[model samples]
Target: MNRRAFALTFGLGLAALASPQAAWAEDHLAEAVRHTKAAVDHGKQGQAEVLVTHAESALTHAEAAQKGVYNIHVEQGVSHLKAAIAEGKKSNAQGATEHAAEALTHLEAAKKK
Candidate 1:
């Protein structure tokens, strides 16, 4: 095999390996967005308990998405998720809803990035 061919093959292999990690991060980010939206919806319905559950899930996924990527939007979304969870635990539906809405916005931005 020629040097050029070998280099091309190696580059393609490396690219293939890197793509999976990118896809994994994207998948987790998408999941975080979905969960955050669910939390917002539940909070709107005054279901603090359910909102907390979804927010927790969103936080988990958001943290996972941050494993290999540093995104300010994801970080902000995580913060809002924490606040939402805390407010939900306190049965403050309004506060939780507001936080969840903020989280949704940040997560959506992160997705675009």
Candidate 2:
């Protein structure tokens, strides 16, 4: 009976440890969405320098989130971020804005997953 009790306690302890990792994955995903949103906002404002900078930041965190969940949306978000950076480099505000908007959509989708 004591052995049974120990097994139950051990299982519960493992579950507790797993829960924090799940929560942290969500936190990292949320952070990616936040940064992507900021990049989109900067794109809309035609601030190519700031937009590129924020897109780089968002891509880094989005990549981290993808490591935790391996979601397709996160992968798509990274693609859009790369496009945004390229457009920003050319000083093409409209193209950067469109790409950033797409990245934002992908980020939101990843958040749901």
Candidate 3:
């Protein structure tokens, strides 16, 4: 009975992994959006350090999304995200905010496709 149960569990896990059920591109895009929102909020409060953290996360997710399905908008978003990070690290809140917003716009457009 234990052996049977183990086999069943293993088989189910393999099947679940093989299934093309999840939308990976969408998931990555969603993560990017969430982090971008947080970054925007932090930027508004002039928290450049915190904003940079979220912007980095957003950039990671954006790059993941770009990998799943190549899109020009996603590529542009990655570029903007990089700029946001650079500006944030330099303690330039205004520049970071602008770049982060640009990244979001590109990400949103990519999400639609």
Better of 1 and 2 by TM-score: 1
lDDT of 2 by residue, 1-113 (tens): 99999999999999998788777767877887887788888888889989888888888888877776778888998899899989998988779879989988988987876
Residue 24 Cα positional deviation in candidate 1, in Å, after optimal superposition: 0.6
1-113: candidate 1 lDDT, tens digit per residue = 69999999999999998889888989999999999999999999999999999999999999999885889999999999999999999999999999999999999999998
**lDDT of each structure?**
0.94, 0.85, 0.89
Please list the residue runs of candidate 1 whose C-alpha ends up more than 4 Å from where it truly belongs after superposition. 1-13
Candidate 2 local lDDT, residue 30: 85
Clashing pairs in 1: none
- In model 2, the worst 10-residue window by lDDT is 20-29
Better of 1 and 3 by lDDT: 1
Each candidate's root-mean-square deviation in Å? 1.8, 2.1, 5.9
Superposition TM-score, candidate 2 onto the true structure: 0.81
Q: How big is the positional error of residue 35 in model 1, measured in Å on the Cα after superposition?
A: 0.8
By lDDT, the candidates rank as: 1, 3, 2
Cα TM-score per model = 0.88, 0.81, 0.80
